[model samples]
Target: MSNALRVLMAQQNFLVGDIPGNTQKVIDGANQARMQQADVVMFPELALTGYPPEDLLLRPSLETRVGQALQRLCDEVRDIYLVVGYPRMRDGKLYNMAGVIHNGQLLGEYAKQCLPNYQVFDEKRYFSEGDQPLVVPINGVPVALTVCEDIWHPGPALQAREAGAQLMLNINASPFHIDKPRHRTELLRERARQAGCPILYVNMVGGQDELVFDGGSKVVDVAGELLFSGDHFQEADYLVEFDSASGRLSCAHPSEPHPTLEQSVYNALVLGVRDYVNKNGFKGVVLGLSGGIDSALTLAVAVDALGAERVEAVMMPFRYTSSMSLEDAEAEANTLGVQYDVISIEPMFDTFMGQLADQFEGTARDTTEENLQARCRGVLLMAISNKKGYLVLTTGNKSEMAVGYSTLYGDMAGGFDVLKDVPKTLVYRLSNYRNSISPVIPQRVIDRPPSAELAPDQTDQDSLPDYDVLDRILELYVECDYSADAIIAEGFDETDVKRVIWLVDINEYKRRQAPVGVRITQRGFGRDRRYPITSGWKAGV
Candidate 1:
C-alpha cells in the first residue's frame, strides 16, 4: 500500500446551465492536478451543473445534459481520479450525486445522504435523500465522499468512519454570510474529531445570483486541527498531502484574514457584480449618484467591480438639491475616473408637477412632491441604462430599505442593489475605508449631513433616528432577530426599539420589490428574511 497520497481541492467557479463550460472547468482542474502528480482531485458540489441549479433540475433535458457532461468529464480526465458533482435522475427520482471517476471510467457514485431545506436551500424539493453511505478505495486509500449538506449531519461521517474509510472528502457550494468561515471551520474540526479521518472540505467560490460563495476551502486532521485553508471570495486550487501510514495530512497555509467587515463586504459585492455582469454578458453598470453616501459607496464598488471605464455615474439633481451636493458628487466621479453626466431633473419634475397641479389643490404637497423628484431621476437613469446596455445599480442601504425610506420604482429601480444588506452606518464606514485607500469619495460626502434633497432643508434625521442609534436597533431586530420587548430588555429605550422594529415590519412590501444585493450579514433583507408583507403580528413592546 502507498504510504503517501496526494489530493487536490478545486475551488473553482461554475456558471449555471453552462453544462459544457462547467464540464471544461472540472476537466481543467483535473488536468492541473495530474500535472502536479496528484492522485485525486475533488471539485465543489454540483460542479458539473453549477451549484444550486435551483429550478433547473426540474427540466428533464437539463438533467440529461448534466449526465452527459459528467460522463464526458470522466472520459476526458483519465490520468487522475476525479470527484465531480451533478444532478442524477434514476428510477424517475432525482438525486444529488457525486461521481468518482478514474482511468476514463466511472468507478463509483454517491448520492448526498442529507438534504438541506431551509434558508436559501431547497434541496429536498429537488432530490431524494440517500440511505446508504459510499466508501470507495482510491490507490489503496479508503475514501468516503459526501456532498454539501451531507457532512453537516453526523450520520454520514460516522457511517463512513464505521465503514473503515481512511479519509473523507466533502464538497460544498456554501453561501457566505458574515463570519460564516469561522463557523464552518469549527464544524469541520468537530466532524474531523468524530470521524477520526483527515477531512478535505472543498467549497465553491463565486457569486451565483443573490448567493455569494466564499471559497476558504479547508482540510483538517483527525484530531480536529486545521491543516490548511484556501482564500475567501476567490478561486483557489490547493493540494493536500496525506501520509497514509502515519495518517497525517498537511497543505499550504491559509490566507490572511479579511481586514475588516467592510473590506469583506466590499469584496463580496465586487465579485457579485462582476459575475452577474460578465456571466450574463452585460456591458457595464449605470447608477444615479445622488451625492449621498449610499450612491457614492455604490459607485466606488461598481468602479472596483467593472472598472472605471465600464461604470457611469450620473447626477440627477432636482430644484432642491444643494450646490455642495453637486460639487461633492462631481469630485467623487472625478476621483473614480469614471464617465460622469449631469442630467438635471428640473424639466421632468416640472412636467410631472404641471400634470399634478389640479389634483394637488386639496392635498397640501406632502410626500407626493418628494416622490416626483425621485421618479424623474429614476426615469432618466433607466433611459441611460436602456440605451447604453448598462445594468442600473440601486444605491439604497439596508437601514433605508428596512424602513421604506426609499421610494419604490424610483431610486430603487435598478438591476442590482449593491448595498442592500449594508446599513447606513456601515455605508459611512465603507465610504471612509474606500477613501482611505484612494480618496475617491470627497471628504465632504462622508462628513456632510445625508439627505434626499427632495424638499427644502431636508435631512435624513428628520424622518429616521441618528444612524448610530438606528443601526444598533436594526442590528438587534434584524440580525439578532429580537422582538421589540427583547430589544428593550437588552437595555435599549423601549420607544426607540419599537419605532425601529415597527418601520422594519411595516416596510416588507417595499423590500419585496427591491433589487437583490450581496448578503454580508446573517439576516439580510433577501432570502434570509421572509416576513409577510401583510402581517398584523408586531412585537408589542
Candidate 2:
C-alpha cells in the first residue's frame, strides 16, 4: 500500500487523424512523467486520433493504424502507467475508448457512456456507448476511468463510487465556447461530491479548424473545491501528488488566474486563425484593411497569431473611401508592423459599370454599384492570393451575416472568415482588449461610426439598428431562438423586431455559402446552429 501517488496531467494539442504522430506524443509524455518520478501520466480524450476524428474514423484502414499506434504506446511507456484515449473497433462496432498501459502490457479499458449529438458534437455518429463501469487496480489502489462525455451525466460518476474506486480519471477534448469553463467546473464539482472522491480532468488544448480547445484542466475535492488548474489555451504537463490513504490531493503549484472574457475570446480568435493557416499549409494570410472596427480587429488577431511577417494588409479604396479611412488604415498597419498595400477600386468599378451599360439601360443604380465596389476588392484580393499564395481572410461579422447585409462573392468571398460567428458588439470589445495590450489600433477608428464606405456619407445605422440594440436582439432571436412577437413583447419596438427577424430569416441562403469562422458563442453559425435555406416557417408568437 502506497501512501502517496503522483500524477502527471499531459494537457496537449493533437492534429486529427495523425495516428503515428499522436502515438509518439503519448510515448514522449510517458517518458517525461517517468523522468519526473510520477507514478502515472494521463492524456486528453482521443489523443491518439485527435478530437472528433470526424469522417476519418470511417476509413477502412483506421483500425489497423490505431492498433499499431497502441502497440507503439505500450512498447515505449516503461516506468509510468500511461492512460490514453483512442477510437476502437470491436465486434463490428466503433467506440470511443480509453486504456491503461504499463511495461508493454495493456491493463483495463473503459468506453464512453454518453454520446453527445448536440451543438458542436456528433459523437453518436462514430461511437457506441458502454453500459458497464471499469475500475482497475494500480499500486494497491482502486482507480476508475471514463472518457469525454462519460462524466457529463451522473450515472458513470456515481457508478464508479459504488464500484469501490477511490480515484477517478476523466479525459476530454472539449472545445471552447463562452462561459464553458465555468459550466464544466460546476458539473465536475457536483460529480466529485457525488463520488465522494477527488477527480482529475485532463482536457485538450489548441485550435482545430474553427474550434479552439482551451485546456484549463483541473481537479476538485469531494467538497467541490478546486485543487488547481492548468494554464488556459496552453499545452503543458503539471504534477499532482495524492494521498490515497487520507483521500487528499494537491497540486505542487498554485493555479493561474482565470482569464477575462475579453482575453479568452481574443485568445480563441488568435489560436483559431494560427492553426487554420499553419496546419493547412498556407504561406500566410491577406485581408482587406478598412478603417472600420471589424477589419482593424481582424488585422490585430492575424498579426498576433501568425506574426507581422506572415500577415499582409491591403486597403482597396474607392471614391467613397474617406481620407480618414486611408490614414487610419495605414496607421494601424504600421503600428502592428504588418505589410501594407493600397489599391484603388475606382477603375474596376468603372469598367464593370461601362461593360454593363447596355444591359442596365432600363434600371437605376442602387446597391449594384456598392456591391461592385466590394466585388472588385474581393477579386483583387483573390488574385493576390493566387499570385502570392496567401489565403484571403474575410472580415464580415455575425451581425451583418445574420441579415442580408453582406455582399455575396464580394465581402463574403475569401478562404476563411475571422469574425463570421462573432457578433458586432464582441468585435468592438475585442478591439478594445487588443488595444489595451499596447494601443495599436488608431484611437479615432474605434471612436468613429462604423460604415461600409461604399457610398457617400453612408453609415451602418442608415439602414440597420444600433449595434448595442441589434446585438441583443440577435442574441434573443438568433442565439436563443426567440420569435419576433416574443422579442417585441420584451419592450422592443415591433417594427424593429419584425425587421430584424425578417432579415435573419430571409438570409439563410447567404449564410449557407459564408466562409467558416471561429464559434465563440453557445450557438454560432455553421456547425453549432443549422437552419434550412428554403423554410416556409414564419417568426411569430
Candidate 3:
C-alpha cells in the first residue's frame, strides 16, 4: 500500500450557467494537477455549473448538459483522480453530487447530505437531501466525501468516521461575509476532531452578482491544526501531501495569517467589481465623483479593480456643489490616473425648473428641487454610459440605502452599486484603509463629513443620525432582526430607534430598485434579506 498521497485543491472561479466553459476548466485543471504529480484533484461544489445557478437549475436541459459535461471530463481528463461537484438526477429527483473519476471511468458519487435553504440558499427548492455517506479508496487510503454544508453539522463527519474514512474532503461554493473565514476555521477544527481524520476543504472564488466567494481553501490535520490556507479572493491550485502511516497531512508552507477586517472586506469589494465588470463584458465603469467619501472610495476601488485606464470619473457640479468638492474630485481622479471630466448641471437644472414652473406654482420648494439636481447628473452619467458602453456605478452606501436617503432613478441609476452593503461609518474606515495602502483618496475626503452635495451646506447628519450610532442601530434592527424596543434596550435613544426603523421599513421600495452591489455582511439589502414592501408589520417589542 502506498504510504503517502498528494492532493491538489482546485480553488477556481466559475461563470454561472456555462456548463461547457466550466467543463473545460475542470479538464484543464485536472491536466495541470497531473503535471504536478497529484494523486487526486478536488474541485469546489457545483463546479460544473457554478454555485447558486438559481432558476437555471430548473431548465429542462440541466440533466442533459450536466451529463454531457461529466462525459467530457471523463473523456478528456486522464491519469489523475478527479473529485468534482455537479448536479445529478436519479429517480426523478435532483441531487447536489460529487463524483470520483479515474482513468476515463466514473468510480463513485456522493449526494450532498445537508441542503441549505436559508439566506441566499434555496437548495430545498430543487435538490433532495442525500442520506448516505460516500467513502472512496484513493491510493490505498479510504477518503470520505462531503458537500459544502455537510461539514457544518456533526452528523456528516461522525458518519464518515463510522464508515472507516482515514481522510475527508469537503468541496464548497461558499460565499463571503464578514468573519466568515474565522468561523470556517473554527468549524473545520471541530469537524476534523470529530471525524478523526485530516480534512482538506476547497472553495470557489469570484463574484456572482451580489455574492463574493473569498477562496481561502484550507487543510487541517486530524487534530484540527490548520496546515495551509490559500490566499483570499484569488484562484490558485495548492498541493498537500498526506502521510498514510501517520494519518497526517503536510504542506510546503505554513498557514497564511488571516487578514484584518478592513483588508478582507476591501479585497472582497475589489474582486466583486472586477469579476462583475469583466465577466459581463463591460467596456469599463464610470461613476459620479461628488468629492464625497462614498464616490471617492468607489473610484479608488474601481481603479484598483479594473485599473485606471478602464475607469472614468465625472464630476457634475451644481450650485450646491462646493469648490472643495470640485477640487477634491479632480484631485482624486488625477491621483488614480483615470480620465476625469467636468460637466456642469446648471443648464439642465435651469431647464427642468423652467419646465416645472407652472406645475410648481406657489408650492414651497423642499426636496423636489434637490432631487431634480440629482436627476440631471444621473441623466448625464447614463448618457455617457450609453455612448461609451461603460457601466455606470452607483455610490450609495448601506446606511443611506437603509433609510431611503437615495433618490431613485437619480443617484441609483447605475448598473452596479459598489458600496451597496457598506455602512457610512464603514465607508470612512474603508477610505482610510485604502489610503493606508497607497493614499489614493484625498485626506479631506475622509475627514470631511459626508454629504449628498444636492443642497447647500448640507451634511448627512442633517437628515439622519450620526453614522456610528446609525450603523449600530442598523446592525441590531436590520441584520439582527431586533425590534425597536430591543434596539432601545441596546442603549440607543428610543426616539432614534423608532425613527430609524420607520425609515428602513418605508424605504424598502427604494432598496428594491437599487443596483446590485458587493455584499460583505451577514444581512445585506440583497438576496440575503427579503421583506415584503407593503407589509403592515410595524416596529414593536
- Model 3 residue runs over 4 Å out of place are none
TM-score for each of the candidates: 0.96, 0.98, 0.99
| Best-fitting candidate, scored by lDDT | 3
Top-TM-score candidate index: 3
Model 1 lDDT-worst window of ten: 252-261
Candidate 3 residue lDDT tens string, 1-541: 4479899999999999999999999999999999999999999999999988998989999999999998998889999999999998989999999999998899999999999999888899999999999999888899999999999999999999999999999999999999999999999999999999999999999999999999999999999988888889999899999988887677754567888999999999999999999999999999999999999999999999999999999999988889999989999899899999999999989999999999999999999999988899899999999999999999999999999999998999999999999999888889999999998888998888888877778999998899999999999998999999888888999889999999999999999899999999999998989998999998887
Which residue pairs come into collision in candidate 1? Answer: none
Residue 386 accuracy (lDDT) in model 2:
91
Compose the digit string of candidate 2's lDDT tens values, residues 113-177.
89899999998888898888888887777889988788789999889999998889999999999
The full ranking of all candidates by lDDT, starting with the best, is 3, 2, 1
TM-score of decoy 1? 0.96
**Which RMSD does model 1 reach against the true structure?**
1.6
User: Residue 284 error for model 3, in Å?
Assistant: 0.2
Question: Which of candidates 1 and 2 reaches a greater TM-score?
Answer: 2
Each prediction's whole-model lDDT (CA): 0.87, 0.90, 0.93
Q: Who is ahead in lDDT, 1 or 2?
A: 2
